[model samples]
Target: MDLLTPDLGLFIWNLLAFLILFFILKKTAWKPILKSLNEREKGISDSLATAEKVKAEMAQLKSENEALLAKAREERAALLKEARDTKDKIINEAKDQAKLEAGKIITDARAAIEQQKMAAITEVKNQVGNLVIEVSEKILRRELSNKSEQEKYIKDLANEVKLN
Candidate 1:
């Protein structure tokens, strides 16, 4: 029974010690502990707020990047269309130039053929005139071959004149 029971003097001494320790701890440690707890709470709240702000910024950046990608795609399509149009125009122009060159070549060939035909016609006419002159000279040379034949012909012409 005595072991389980506190003595009166011991109780009074314990009460005094408890009162002193409470006062010392209240004076020295309470404010620092409460301030540290508040600072820790504030730090946690700031970190959470910063995280949320970063998440929002990241979302905005993602949206902006998607928009930029879309714009780049549109620009690329327009550039491709323009390049195709330019290529078609160049091809058409080249075809037109080729056609013009072919026409010029054909016209030049026709003119050259006409000039050759005219030259051949002139050569044939000159040859025919020479041949006619040669035939006439041969006939005239046969007719005037002998002086005795010319005298006999003159005597026959005189006899016919006297009979008439």
Candidate 2:
């Protein structure tokens, strides 16, 4: 019973000390603690907003990269097509040039062959004329060995010419 019951003067003094301590803490520490908590909240919100902005920029950059890649692919295809066309054109031109060159060579060869044939014919005719002259000279020398034989051969040639 004595422990449970407090003296009035002690109770009044304890209450006064607690009230003074509470007021002192409120006046000295409350405003700074509240200001620190508000600053921390604002920093967190700013960080989150910055992160969202960065994420949006990354998405836009990814789309731009994809567009650039598509354009590069199209350019590559066009360049390859142009290269193939150029190659075909060059090959066709070379083939046409080869055909013309071959035709010119054939024409030149034919002309050369025809010229050689005419030359051979002329040579054969000249050789035949020379052989005929040599044979007639020998025959006349043998037949005209005596004057009487020469006269008889001349009379025979005249008679043959008259019959023809």
Candidate 3:
């Protein structure tokens, strides 16, 4: 109970000292503390704003990258398709040329075979005609040895011709 109640004179002295200290701190420390706090708050806010801006730019760049990738894929697909078409066209042309060459070869072979057959037939006929002429000449030489036999054979041939 005694410690809880202070003397009036002591209370007055303590109040006076507190007022002096308060005024001194207000003039010297308050402004600097408040200014430092405000500067820290401003710096924090600026950092947050910069982070948000960077995040937005990153999102935009990501979208741009996706668009470029899609375009590249489309171009690659088109190029592959064109290459396939070109390959097919070249293969078809080669096949068609091969067929033409085969047909031409067959036609030439047939024409050559026909020409060889005709040449064989003409040679056989010429050989037969020459043999017949030689046999007839030999028979005539043997039968018509003198003029009397030739005249007798001519009379017999003329008489046989009249009867037929």
The C-alpha TM-scores of every prediction are: 0.73, 0.69, 0.68
**What is the per-residue lDDT of model 3 for residues 1-164, given as tens digits with 9 covering 90 to 100?**
87999999999999999999999999999999999999999999999999999999999999999999999999999999999999999999999999999999999999999999999888878776776575556547776678998777666654544211
For model 3 the local lDDT of residue 65 reads: 100
Which pairs of residues clash in candidate 1, taking residues 3 or more apart in a chain or in different chains?
Answer: none
Model 2 alpha-carbon drift over 4 Å, by segment: 1-22, 144-164
lDDT of 2 by residue, 1-164 (tens): 97899999999999999999989979998888888999999999999999999999999999999999999999999999999999999999999999999999999999999999999888888776766565556557675678888777766654544211
CA lDDT, every prediction? 0.86, 0.85, 0.87
Worst 10 contiguous positions by lDDT, candidate 1: 155-164
Give one digit per residue, the lDDT tens place, for model 1 in 80-156.
Answer: 99999999999999999999999999999999999999998888887767765765555456675688986675555
Model 2 sits at a Cα RMSD from the real structure of 8.9
**On a 0 to 1 TM-score scale, where does candidate 2 land against the true structure?**
0.69
Number of the top TM-score candidate: 1
